[model samples]
Target: MKDGDETRQREDTPFYDHPTGGWGSLKSVARWMVKGRPSPGVLDTLRIQNKPGGHMCTSCAWAKPPNPHLAEFCENGAKATIWDLTRDRCTPDFFARHSVTELQGWSDHDLERVGRLTHPMRYDAASDHYLPCNWDEAFAGIGARLRQLDPRSVVFYASGRASLETSYLYQLFARALGHNNLPDSSNMCHETTSVALKSTIGSPVGTCVLSDFEHCEMILFFGQNTGSNSPRFLHPLQQAVRRGCKIVTFNPVRERGLIEFTSPQEPGPMLTGGSTRISDTYLQVRPGGDIAAIAGLCKHLFALDDAGGGVIDRDFIAEHTDGFASFEANIRETGWDGIEAASGLIRADLEAVAEIYARSPRSIGIYGMGLTQHVHGSQSVQMLVNLLLMRGNIGRPGTGISPVRGHSNVQGQRTVGISEKPELVPLDRLAELFGFEPPRDEGRTTVDAVQGLLDGSVRGFVSLGGNFARAIPDQGRSDGAWAGLALNVQIATKLNRSHVLVGDGTWLLPCLVRAEEDRQASGSQTVTMEDSLSHIHGSVGRRAPASGHLLSETAIVAGLAKATLAPNPRLAWDDWVGDYALIRDLIEATYPEEFKDFNARMFTPGGFYRGNPARERQWKTTSGKAGFTTPTVLSALGAEPGDAVFTLMTLRSNDQFNTTIYGFRDRLRGLEGDRMVVLMNPGEMARAGLHEGQRVTLVSAVEDGKTRALPGMRVTGYDLPDGCVAAYYPEANPLVPLGWHDVESKTPAYKGAPVRIVA
Candidate 1:
């Protein structure tokens, strides 16, 4: 029941009351640096992060400002850099000291805390340990195993950590093996955003540039926690607030960063302990209620416009959009009673938000995972776009939809063709550039990949970089399915649960981290990353690799491809790995529209923005106009919770980023050395006959005949909606059923999980 370190008893913990991003952030950064004990040049490596001709921060994909501050990275960014640059190494000796079973007994945190992987390894089932293996033999064995299975039965999963060049090559490698089963980290996070935005505005990416915040009169946040997920974004929000911009937030939890923020870079705040108020209005909407809340805003806006308030942009809607009449009718037909019940907010609050929208000539709507991980996640996104469209928010300066992406290059990965859906990518261009007929069939998504494994249809899984076993939903089913795979391979930088959960033909190929230099046969190579706003920039690693045995991701992919497929006269895998510029040139050839002058544009100062047609009102939809759709469902979780049931939403701690747990201390949440605690509303706890600090188990309310329960969760009363509760992710991922996902996007419903507290 324990996870290495002792969980801080509830009696010893108090709620954090200080502002976000102040002295607390500095202390956390220093503590992490000390704990990680990064190499001597780690500080200098951080200095170039998000800077021109320097490596990008391996943290969130928040765009770097045109003129970045001297110390541009955030506390979490420092942790990620320090974590990647750690002196500790998981060597062959570490594997010799413990078997896979013994390592499985350790916490996720403990496994990674041992530090970066130092050598290539292949699992020896007889010895129950991973023995060091040369790259050649490992790739040969893997290629042989892969060749034995049907390409459709194999899954290639990638994390956002991979650079654009690496991702592009990864997809080509998969298709060369004869399938398009490419699923990346985006499938689990922002897949809904892509599906919805493409259907609505004809572009999958967000329309807002970072500078839009400065010019916007109002910024509305839904479901995103800026402080933890995208801390660097706080600078723009802080600046906007200083200029008297209106900031409104709607989330289940009252995040500290949305309430107030004190920038560490601000000398006045650091010296005087002053903090800038962030959200002028904070609404605690229920989990999975974003769609209803957005609908209410639209309804109120319609009412205002009907009364001749000059709220609706009639000219823009008539000129640039379609289905306005039906969209307006649906909004008007939806009763306030239903909206209030589903949203967990009164009509008055929505009206107030509508008033703010009406007053502001320019506005931006920002969202994150909170809105994306639900059964109606796609609909929720559409609703937000619908609300923006009512006021002609898109295709204008200081106004657009912004989905805060999690990983540094998650958006970039998708841009360079890491996708399951074949139609989303340019197949003709890929075939022309690579001299191979690419697969046209729809590939497997993360959810379908897990399903394929459970049903014995999938024989292999290859992850470019991610904690695949830990990050996926329904851990009980997924972990078992992973261990039963015919082949499992992880191209990674560090030790994690995924690497140890070995199966047949399992191999661990260590790769150079983001902060390390990636010198190939030609010369030192620099990879490019696309930020959330479509800005493409170069990232050239400066520090030495953690181990001499480490290979660049590009090299690893090339080695695997060369080993797997018979050499084609035109395909030069080794050549592409030797000089990345060649890879970029091919990328430009593949997507001339997006990556035109790819190599030249990537190194430009602050990078160039690949223009979005939606941003220019050049609608690429089938009807040649932005379309508005109506959502019939009021609640993402379906029916309302009966008696003891509560809507459970999983979230990340301040000490964590995605699935990587840096340490047990969550500074903003006031939890030290613990992550198994759940936050609940005081009234909700009292209603359920549970006291503060009560140790209880959470049982999934899904009627699947599966005993999905998480025991040993300490209850802590906090500020949240009355019928909603929050817990840390990956731990709570088991309670979320694999089938419970957005119907359109197939994104697992991690936010609106129905659960009941049991003693």
Candidate 2:
């Protein structure tokens, strides 16, 4: 029960200093399998085969390789699945023992660990506890609230966990109920990627597939922790390394995956008693400084072009790209002085990066939340595309821009009707297929939803899946905003902080997790999900329900639609839940271009890769070409020189997925049993008149006359840029203002919040 200093001391005893996913990964997997006993058989839970026949790993959105290794799933993926398949049950009886107020006092990790929800529970104000309710009664009441309230007053929030079928049904239900307020978790994480890429390459996804690593000569990582976030990704990276493909990483913190990694499944590396060095050159860029570094790369590229004839791809630029001359001029104007000052990197470092970029026949750029979670995040992504377009790195074998997604099927969710902006697709087509006029008005995003709640406009909130209260930014204000809602409904597999913090009338709907047997009236059903690379594949649940009270996400959405969109035989919401193929048929009709061979291609062992015109040199743009954009070079950290002030970026612990806490320990980071800690440089700590493991309050630099202080946070000295620090979030999310987000994407600038320590 010892906290912080004591618990961290326990984790500091290193078993091995080797790279990620070695024996360490195996040990972690084994520990989790047994940690929560009475769970599904370990092998069955891991889905040791391709989905539909089995199931997909319930973790990150890394592409499932065509010819997967003996084991495609990773230790973290196993942990994610095991966490879902827990032994203890959070039944109505368990809720009776602990009141809502009492449960609110528990930690997020403890809330998940207490057990799986066994029944649909309704919040009782008199007893101050959740009481069991039947499905019909709960659905009727929730439907009544939706019917009575103004359509705009309802906020329909979807998470990445829901299947494509469920997401489509949920979105349809919301639109049919005369509202477009579909705010999803993507608004928090990768919305910037979608916004930037769509404008640049006429696509919003990674152009490279899993096999691209084979032909790639060099891979550049900007702000991504590939080792911890996407462990399965290391297989290709390790392969590329063995093939003499150089790996260069730009991150403030030296992640284990980027350092040295031994692929545990690969016999040669794992048994050789040595680890593969992942990064040949690693540069520690300041937090939110990715744009500057990327701009530096572009500036250096132009510098090379000025010196010689061979550096610029003039033919490709003339034929396939737009705005090249202006882009080059902007890069030259920014110059190395501004780039070095903002990026925390010098001219020599950027020049070194450009040398590799110029020399390599094929190169790839990869990044995650670190790059996409900022005020200028969308522009930063376009800047990356600009760098890639310099050499025509996109639309060819082994070369492209990759925005590594954190959640499984997150991109897929957006692909299948989960959007606040209906302009993403043609409304006429949707109306023809569904027999209803789709709402055209712009809806609230995650931030907009919070504002709606605060302003008394949002009366009801429904979540498909996710810890909304914990996962979002501005938690203190958002939690307060939730209190004004008349109804709050959560359809989930497990318990989290969001369920505890609710409105006047609250309902917790216990739903089935991914790949859990979803037996419908038709017999057995399979749901499809699109991966990071947009490969749509079938994922069928094989495990029995955790409790008889559990219902599939698809069924829950269908039931809600049946109740809310009443007296509708033509739509047949009730029949669609009986068989998912009917749902797929409707989806294919709705999006014929994307889901063209919707049913046929899914039978393929891995799945079918959807059309990426950008990858094929087919630009679907206003000018019929890839557009080079002039991204405003906003300084990563806006703070002028004063004291030891630093730009703070929220980080995910090694043991977490979004807001779900697997454990209190971030073992890879050498920290344990505490979330309220900051990682800073030893030199910066000393200069600030602070010591290692010193606890201090952090105050937001961009406070609007209000004190944005996070007290009881411990500062630990480590290696980082002087004006930057890292802290694990949900804990640090409070410091990021709700309105402090990208203008284009509106994603909360979680990775680039300005803060300083107060002793």
Q: What's every prediction's RMSD, in angstroms?
A: 3.8, 3.6
Top-TM-score candidate index:
1
| Candidate 2: Cα lDDT at 301 | 77
For candidate 1, write residues 1-759 as lDDT tens digits: 111111222233355778899999999998888999899899898888888888799999999777889988999999999999999999999999999999989999899989889899999889999999998898899989988989999999998989989999899999888898999889898999999999999999999987788899999899998899889898999999999899999988768888879999889989998999899888888998888899899999988988999999989999999988988889899999999999999999999989999999999999998889888889889888988888899989999999999999999989888999899888887787668898999999999998898898999999999998888888767677777888999998888989877876899999998888999888899999998999999999989998999999999998898889988866788889889999999888877888888887887776789879999999989889998988879877744676888888998989999999998887787667768888886777777888887899998898887889999999987767778788999899988888888888988888888899997
Global lDDT of each candidate: 0.88, 0.82
Clashing pairs for predicted structure model 2, backbone only: 19-260, 515-541
- Weakest ten-residue segment in model 1 by summed lDDT: 1-10
Model 1, residue 524: distance off in Å is 0.9
- The alpha-carbon deviation from the true structure for residue 655 of candidate 2, after best TM-score superposition, in angstroms, is 1.0
The C-alpha TM-scores of every prediction are 0.97, 0.96
